[model samples]
Target chain A: MSQRVPVHVEVNGRGYDREVEPRRTLADFLREDLGLKGTHVACEHGFCGNCNVLLDGAAIRSCLMFAVQAGGRSVETVESLAGSDGELDELQLAFTEHHALQCGFCTPAMLLTAKQFLRENPGVTDARRIREAINGVICRCTGYQQIVAAIAAVAQAQQTAHSIRIETAPPVRVAQDTR
Target chain B: MLAGGQSLVQLLKFRRCRPSALVDINGIPGLDAIERRDGELHVGALVRQQALLDDPQVAESWPLLREAAGFVGYPETRRRGTLAGSLAFAAPWAELTAAAVALDAQLDICSAAGQRSLAAREFFRGPGETALGDGELIVAVRFPAPAPGTGAAFHEVSVRHRDYAQVAAAAQVSPDGHGELVLLCVAPTPHRVDVSEALTRDDAIADLLGRLDPLDDVEASASYRQRVAPVLARRALRDAAERAHRRAPA
Candidate 1:
């Protein structure tokens, strides 16, 4: 048997310390070790982005990283999307309202991937860019049309909110008018 | 040992390779920098593909690296895959290998014996193979600055967007119309061809294509690569030439 290594990681805002086999994947560690089953694993390889999770705010394929490699890093999984009261976030609600998922096996990863996309590209509603952003996560269901729509809807809402905030800002007095 | 385990971890899961001990190099300091020294860009071993693509200096100067990096896997994979890791993996279809060869990048290797430098062209022996001997690790890669008024472009055709290229071409052209072309997925290693005159001569292009022994795997047939390679080479060369002319000083 291979020796187990000590791994300390922050997942979903909680710290967990465990001793696991050095070869264990982060996907397996999250599901089996921590019972955070929200992060699903389909293709053990990196081909399918089904195992994507946020490592320090950037989306990464958990299956491609060893559990020990995640030591001292912060990982955000699908479980972090909803609040403690089970209240869904804006992106999650958009997914449901737009019917972005069907079989739901790829939903968790898709959400995380989209979350990173939205964070990197603020208020970008371009369908082509959105498709490119989530291109890693292969969805056998939903045809990706709804998923693109859901992300675009959120971006559009954010853009409108930003404009409203800018318009409502206090006006600056001109020196010439004061004189 | 691993920098980015995007490929190594998958191999482990498949039981293709088993090392008694696994070394994680992600915590190593100073190995993740993308620095500019003298006239070359020195990319450390742990610099991620996405980080290289996002570097403004890379996009402004070494556009070929940026373009090729944009074709590697996807955002998530690029976030975890390192440039040195890609070169060390030496996958035949890896875009960075083609870019490195085309740009004449030099790799900095080190081991207990000491340090040495190897040109990118001499690094690859075959698929999943490199000139790196036992205990040798690639510390960084030095990509020389493109000549003044030089521009580059990378083009490839994959089964899907961001998939492994069936055949890809990377080209860089100077204002004088002299340049190099590197072809990927058309040989066991990234193949460099003389594009200084081949771009204008059909016979020269055909001669270069006739020498390639592309793989006959499931992704694409060898015949298809033979048919598509020249077209990609021409497109990349034309685009690069146009950009080079635009950047040329009056």
Candidate 2:
């Protein structure tokens, strides 16, 4: 038998220590051990993003990685996206507004993916580009057009606000202090 | 594990490959560089397809390569798919291997022994096979710097953008220099055509046609693939030449 290794990891900002088999996948640890059922496992394989989570800030498929490999890593799931007050994020609101989901099985992964994408591309103006970026995600319900629209709306709104600030914000006086 | 798992995991589910153990190489450090040194571009093995699609260096220096990367799988798959694993497998129908072969790229590989380099043409052996020795791993791939006036293009036809390529082709043309054209996914390895002689002729396409012998498969007939190869090759050549012309001094 291979030796069991001890791993310490932080999930949703909470740390935990566990001794586990070297072969155990991170997805199993997340769902079976931690009981964070929000991270679904549709394809145990990597095609479906249902098992996706943010690993050290980048989106990765948890099912394809081993628990030992993720040792000492910071992981975030869909469950961590909400505020303590249980308020839905702008992306969640947009998803609901556009009816981007039907079965809801793929929603958690979709939302998490879009969240990461939006952060990297803070202010994109083109809807076509957004649609193309999200094209790999499969929605059996064929509700993708709306999802793209919702994300684009949020991005456009952010861009417009940024441009307004650039145009209207006042400049500092010559006596501006640098301390 | 299995690096990207974009195509591998799907194959596992379909019973195509069932390894008892899958080593995850994504977490491996220093496997995602896209640096240019001297006169070659070195792309780290684990670099994601999505990263290639949006890389400024790739976009400006090799637009056709970027466009080819964009056409692979889909957004989610691209986010996880690694260039090394895709080529290492070299399945009969992989578009990446075809593109690499067409571009005359060099593969940098690592194994228990040490590091070795193989030209793309020699790396691919047969369907689902490669020249990779056991315990060896691909570290990166290198592409030669584009000449003063060079252009390249990659194109493929599939049931969908994300589907396995039914027919794929890539071409590179150098002004007043040698040209390389290849067809992908039509056989075990990407088929390269030595167009040095035909390229000098006025009707290069007609001459190039005489040298090609396409394979027959269910997705597309061998005859059709053979016929389509020339058309795609011609288009790729024309596009490359035009691009080169635009970059030339007035």
Candidate 3:
């Protein structure tokens, strides 16, 4: 049997074609083949919650998934959480401002997990719920308080920004007949 | 065949499930559907653990499952773990087994040869074991319709929120006033105990711990399981019974 299998996939909106072994995990694929080192792996097992990335927009353990399994699917890594021009997204900014990470090992997974959580639950304002939603992203250094605060701050900002857009709507200029 | 890679991939990485070739089943259409069919909710093979808890219809129709779903792996794990996959893996520590036992669920499986049905209780034989034959795969699980006045409660004691429970308890009260109590992670597999007057009596709840000798593992001791099993059983039964009463009709 051939050792390597062909795979075509999209990562962070860019398409790529690559060959991977049947047993090669997606984590190894991104970090090694694609040079997307932003996604880190700590436990290698699924328990540690590092190595997390969005597959077809849902967060999953890349360490537990083979690159062949991700064939034809779109993956969004921790690197995708940053803006196109290299600016950090809102959650990333909040994590930086709040000092949500100390060692920075779990930050990539944390950001992707929090990004999905925030996007899925934009209307949710409960700090406790936000903490629970991101519970899977384990942070050994932050003690979780500041991390929760960071996510909560972003959620609050989103809510405030939404209300501001609603309250500051421009007056409707009715279309008039131009003779 | 791989449905959820949560367990299978880990096993593969550890040189456990080195099946010559893995048939990825994620592309099977309509396998992800969680729907109500003929008064019973059919949970397809690809239904994620997170979806069972997140769906309002499922949460309302099957509280036993909804509550138990929370005690499974972490959110990230559940985001990929499937109910059918858990049952197929047949891990005793799995929350789905206890819920299936309490809910009296049925398993539907198929192979290139044919199709067949098995009771959830009979499907599980031991840890990492099931009645599934070679070339066969679980297709879907059927949960009984919610009967009036029925309520459920689940409780588990774990070292951490996301870690598997050293011992877990799930109790379901039928509308007719009988309750099925299931205990997990203590034996080779989760088994149901016939608790007489389970909803009202403390003796029956405590008797749940007497059904088996706990297995000692890295997370807990046998003696600890013996002591804590009853406490979790009592809480589960009490909450289920009380809620069942509130939901019961005149």
Highest lDDT scorer? 1
Q: What total of clashing residue pairs does each candidate reach?
A: 0, 2, 0
Q: Give me the runs in candidate 1 sitting further than 4 Å from their true place.
A: A172-179, B202-204
lDDT comparing candidate 2 with the true structure: 0.76
Which candidate do you rate higher for TM-score, 2 or 3? 3
lDDT of 2 by residue, B39-68 (tens): 777889888877778788776676656757
Predicted candidate 2 versus true structure: per-residue lDDT over A1-179, tens digit per residue: 37788999899999979888876778899988888999888878776667878888777788877777678889989889889899988888888888888888877877877777788888884777776656545667846777787788778778988999999989866885879
Interface RMSD of each: 0.7, 2.9, 1.3
DockQ of 3: 0.72
Fnat for every candidate:
0.96, 0.48, 0.81
DockQ of each two-chain model = 0.89, 0.39, 0.72
Give the DockQ of candidate 1: 0.89
**DockQ-best of 2 and 3:** 3
Instruction: Find the 10 residues in a row with the least total lDDT in model 1 chain A.
Output: A170-179
TM per model?
A: 0.96, 0.85, 0.94
lDDT of 1 by residue, B1-250 (tens): 6988888888888899988777777878999999789989999999999987889989878888998898898889988889999999999899999999999999999999999999999999998899999888899999999877788889999888788899999999887878889999788999998766675674677666676789788889999998999889888888998899898998
Q: Rank the candidates by lDDT, best first.
A: 1, 3, 2
Residue A43 of model 1 has an lDDT of: 85
